[model samples]
Target: MLDRLAHSRGLPQVIRTDYGKEFCGRAMVVWAHVRGVQLRLIQPGKPSQNVYVESFNSRLRDEYLNEHWFPTLLNARTEIERWRREYNEDRPKKAIGGMTRAAYA
Candidate 1:
């Protein structure tokens, strides 16, 4: 994913997420720092403060995982890639004033 992000059309300035142990680890922190990407991690146990991502996660699970069970990590990755494109380019978002996130972006 880091490779994907680095090669993204336009580099993003800030990325916000929940401070799970995986992201809170020194490795991730250092990686973000080295890449000059700002990582905005919400306080643990305060999910409402990160409502957008939380809701996104819920919707992602509902829209994809609940419908199809992957047999392996590779299948899951493929499913995720498919959904991510639709989510960004097609799905309308309230935060973007009802425009698709891709349109807003």
Candidate 2:
């Protein structure tokens, strides 16, 4: 996921995530350190620390994942990309003064 983001939009200066295995792996730690990306890890069991991401993940799961049944990895990636584009470009977010995320950015 970070690789894809870096490829498309350049690497983020900081990465914020819970201390999940995927985020805490040695490979990811090394990758971030090498790229000078700071990792902000939330305390275990504290979803409030990363409320924005938690909220976004909730909406993505409810609106997209629950509605799709991808039969393959490629199909899943394609569908997820479509949903991501819509979420970032088409949908207006209340938190951003009713602007689409792309516009807000």
TM-score (all chains, Cα) for each model: 0.71, 0.84
Q: Count the backbone clashes (under 3 Å) in each candidate.
A: 0, 0
Candidate 1 to native Cα RMSD, angstroms: 2.8
Candidate 1 lDDT, 1-105, residue by residue in tens: 764867885556777778777877898788888878799988878999888778879989898889998899998999899998998899888877999976787
Whole-model Cα lDDT of every candidate shown, in order: 0.83, 0.92
Which ranges of candidate 2 are over 4 A from the true structure?
102-105
Candidate number with greatest TM-score = 2
| Model 1 lDDT-worst window of ten | 3-12
Provide the global lDDT of candidate 1 against the true structure.
Answer: 0.83
lDDT of 2 at 46: 98
Q: How good is model 2 by TM-score?
A: 0.84
Q: Kindly report which residue pairs in candidate 2 clash with one another.
A: none
